[model samples]
Target: MKILALNGSPRMKASSTYHILAPFLAGMKAAGAEVELIHIRRLNLEVCIGCYTCWARTPGVCIHDDSMADVLQKFNTADMVIFGTPLYHFSMSGIMKTFIDRLLPRFEPWLIPHPHVPGVTGHPERVQKPYKMFLVSPGGFPEFEHFDSLVATFKQMARMENWEYTGEILRPGAEPLSRRSLQNLFTGYYTLLRQAGEELIRDGRISDNLQLQLREDLFPGGKEVFYQLAEGYWTEQMDKFKVPQEQRHTVPLLAKDLDSTPMAPAGSNITNDTSKTGDRYYVSNEVIMQTMTAMYDTKAAPNLQATIQFQIIPPKIDFDPGEAMWYLEINGARCDLHQGKTAIPTLSITTPYEVWYDIGIGNVDALEAFTNGDYEATGSQKLLNDMLHLFPRPEPGSDDPLAAELDTLMMGMPTAFNPEAAKGTNAVIQFILSGKGGGLYFLNIAEGKCTVQRGAAKNPTMTIHCPAETWLAISTGKLDGHQAFMQEKYRVSGDMAILLKFNTMFDTHTN
Candidate 1:
């Protein structure tokens, strides 16, 4: 069998989308199938101008003379066509979409009932030989909803072309799993995705079980750990580029208006006593339970099912030892926060409460704590990682008024809200942050100007809701907003078209 994999990511070598395909391609090659990998961005392809030239003037060919013409031939000759892309705006990337559009020439303009299948639905009839269609996409988010539109488009395309829909591989949390330490965690996933390819080559289709596994969260460590790791990455990037906190948050509407930046967030007032000795803000059992109940967003991780037991040691803990032992069970969409223990829990973690407190407040380095014998996991490390978000850190420092006002502190930062991207646009965008430190804010932009307000919009064009920590991470370039949206960390309901201005509206890096 001959396979053509068209990679649409512009990142090229740095793309996590491309990397996931490595094992799959290797599996196919090992199975004795000839595979050709092509990066679409590398080709000099022109966007389709919606002209009927391809259909009316010259059939089976786009009007523009570009490298896509050769790509078209390869696509036609391949026994199977694999569309590989990084999910963008709940769909394929612009380059890949354009490639799909250009392929319109290979089908008749008029629609009819699918020739091969007897269905009431009508689709553009294919003029060339049929080839099985498969999609390999990696979404940054952990939610399956991110692939909703992309999956629909591909399935429809397959039906329209009268080709069998082989299956898809939608790997969420692609970035987090790509981390060096976490790469080993995906050893089974890598083997499975590659095995999927082998199955395709040998059986002419991918296994259903493997397809389901591909769509599972690539980083089972959950969103909290993922965000922490992401933040470290963004911090490094900021330092590498020497991006000032002011500019990092500034969204210049006009290049000329760079000097008129908004006021940035103030520095933290709580000073850290570097000395690791302190039981002043010691975390109690109640605090842990309240924090979990307040912060856990069932919508963000709807299908995460696991039972975790926390075993706290004495001296480090102030609460009753019996109360210190807690169990958190997340079944389906419900989370049952139970105090005490379970007979056969999915996972158990034993640690000093002091170390746990420090880890919670970002004071203790988890790896170091583990290395220093502060904590130990008696069950699956993966489960412990997945449940880490349930124990979010309290605001840094003592539980004082200043700690509660951390969200407001972040509000003062230059949010990089580019009004220029909305130069000829007008919209009211609402930001509803949940969790312990969340708040509601709105950005009203029109006529190349933006007004930031502390309350909700009366009639908003779009409303984005997420945990406060997630937004903070995105603002700092530690977590990508696009990725967050895909991962279900944030849900957007309203005019999604306005979000397309994200990149054009703000420069993520400093000059």
Candidate 2:
């Protein structure tokens, strides 16, 4: 089958419309369909003048000398045509509308009765050929309702042109698909698009179930969260461009003045304070508790079953009762919060309310606060370390480094440790890394808990010796661990069984 795809986004390859269209065409090509993609922005096509020269003066031939002739030739021969565009003003973009208007040469001037629908008159096609028409569009809005008018227009066009109206692929809240940090959340959506394309080629149509899945949100959060993130993104952009507050709607004339401007790093200015009528109000303990309960990430630790108790001490400000106690019960992806403490908690944190509030609002780093003795954690240290991973904070700035030094990476092992994989395991692993940023560190794993310390371990179950750079690359997924081992880039001594369980034991690559 031959397919022709027209991309009508002004941004061309950078547009979200192309992000969705590229994968679909890839899947079609993989399914043995010949595909041709054309970008309307790159074409030298003019707007239709409504001169009727194509219909009156000459039959089925346009008067304009431009790229539309080539497009028409390809459109006439293709078995299927895909129109990819970004939604503008509740309809297709202006460029797309212009492209559609230029196709008038393909239709005869005479009006005729609709072939399938009753009581409907439409223009007859100049050329009689069976083909399929599909629409692929992405909108900035967060509701599927925004695409209703566009979809209706396409359906009507298909009816008038005597083409099969294949199902459309519509994506709402599509801006996030272009963000590198959030790409993982849309992996399933991209895969679904590929499946839709393959199904259209092999099965003649996408399954009803798959179509429903395609319309689901790209991420788990609702529309409210999407709006918040979008607002944050635009605000950052405005600040980056140095647009004045009064002229925010207008584009800035000059480039960003980096030397004179002071910009806050992404994810650094989040706070829980609100101001109304010049009166400042801090978040109450109840609000904090509710936010924590809502922030639980079930997918991150699906098999984790534990209880965490928070004991908030008195604060300097006037808060009713000044102190509070709360406990969170986590059982295999489910988490419930209670007002009071549980009888037995796997981990208990005791800290001043102010300190806890600072950490909650991202004003202070949680790990740094813990290391500085601002908070006291008792019971299982492993649980204390895994708290951030279980309920991860909002993503850090995109500029954050993907890799860290040996000390920082070693100390973060507990966060990536898989307790389920290391059940009933007790071992000591020693690492003597050489080179810059290297140090001597050892990990003690016992009773499904992991702890790291700076020193050599006596009678170690497994000892690894390697250059720090090589280990860092392996841990951060820059190099394959198994391949590095085979190439003798790193040497392991004693306890070959423990070495074999390294990948399953700790997910260091995620760090």
Candidate 3:
């Protein structure tokens, strides 16, 4: 199925709207569908010339001679017409509005004298099929009625063209989109697009399952779409997730599940402290974990196919023994996990991509990303500093498409699969002792997964013998990775240069 997505952001794909849509489109492509995303910003689109050559010369064709002609063909030729734009001033971008305005020429004055709605006049006899209007807009909060008023303009276009409203999809929390969120949105959105295409070509119906999952996964606040509905329009988002033929009713009939609460609450603030010291504005990183669970958008659920872990090197921690260790349920049982019971809460983070998503001049360092307004930091700044950090974006090499793709390949050693540290020039892999023997270890950059091991192998190039609690300090650079060397907690032999270079690798990567 052919799905044509018109990215109407004036900045084109660089706009926040397009960033979110990219993954969804990619998912559609992955699902074996023909999906073409055309950026309106790249087109030399001109304002309508008001010449009615389309009617006399060719109906449904604009002859003003501009790129809209190509866009129009794409629109008319596809099973789905995806219109993406960021809400600029409580309305669609001028880029999209102007484009929509030009399409007015496609509407001929067919003067059909018809009855009107309760208050309106001269309405179409019947809406046509196949031409569905798919709309996309991104906002900071769940409520977008104010910003999404563009639907009215789109409705007018649909009315004139005699097409059905496939539906307008609103993407919440689209403003200040993160690299991870962008990838998720693109993946989810494209999945729907591809599914829509397949249904149109083969089944003559869009896959309801895919649509619901997409809405639940990407638009967690979609339940609010019907707050103003009369009595029953406030149903499931077409219950695309509720399987079984009988329960497979589209969102039209599914009533609101009152118990369900939406994440990305309107006006909600997100603060992540990237600092790694006593400056923890949020508690011991435990509050941060609770906050993540609280703000979790189950609609955009993550699949744990890949793993990354962060091993906090020690003496970095500022917390005292009095700050109660967070109680965690593990392996169908209670504690008995880490010795000392304070398994420095390891954060295994995964989004659409790894840490290096932001490209080019806009990119900032890990510390700067927090202080310089690159990320939303409410508290726990030091926790970020205490944990792994971002490395500089690597210089691009070769014209490889996958290079342009996300960091699909692993960047470093797996924390769980602790490999024997070879005495490779200037460095030797070392793990800060949580105990003398058995426990999980993490890598510097947060490639997450649980594994058993507490100390390095005998005769390892460098051995760090700090107490289990010092993992945080060593990793954070507070205790100093080299401190173990001086205090004898860390012993180095065999190859010092290789161990030095190895330590430098951790500098570029965080713990």
Question: Clash totals for all models, in order?
Answer: 10, 0, 64
Model 3, runs deviating above 4 Å: 51-53, 56-63, 114-129, 178-511
Ranking by lDDT: 2, 1, 3
lDDT of 3 at 348: 24
Instruction: Please give the CA lDDT of all the candidate structures.
Output: 0.67, 0.75, 0.44
- The residue-by-residue lDDT of candidate 3 on 431-453, one tens digit each, is 33322121212123213231222
Error of 3 at 178 (Å): 5.2
Better of 2 and 3 by lDDT: 2
Prediction 2 global C-alpha lDDT: 0.75
Candidate 2 lDDT over 158-235, as tens digits, reads 886778998899998888776777777878888999998899999989999999999888876797788889999999
Better of 1 and 2 by TM-score: 2
- Model 1, 1-511: lDDT tens digits are 8999988888765677777787898899999999999998999888889887877778666789999888888888998888989999899998898888777677667667656668655646445676888888888776778899999999987776677888888877677544665677788888987898899899987877877777666555677877777789879866765535633322222323112222211331222223444443444655544334434556546655566577766443233423678876665566667777665455666766555555644445555555555576555454454444543433333354433454554454236656656578788776665544555566777777766765335566877656667776776577877877777777666788877775576555211
RMSD of each: 25.6, 24.9, 21.1
Write down the TM-score of every candidate: 0.46, 0.48, 0.36
After superposing candidate 1 on the true structure, give the runs of residues whose Cα lies further than 4 Å from its correct spot.
111-113, 116-126, 177-185, 212-216, 242-254, 257-511
Of 1 and 2, the candidate ahead on lDDT is 2
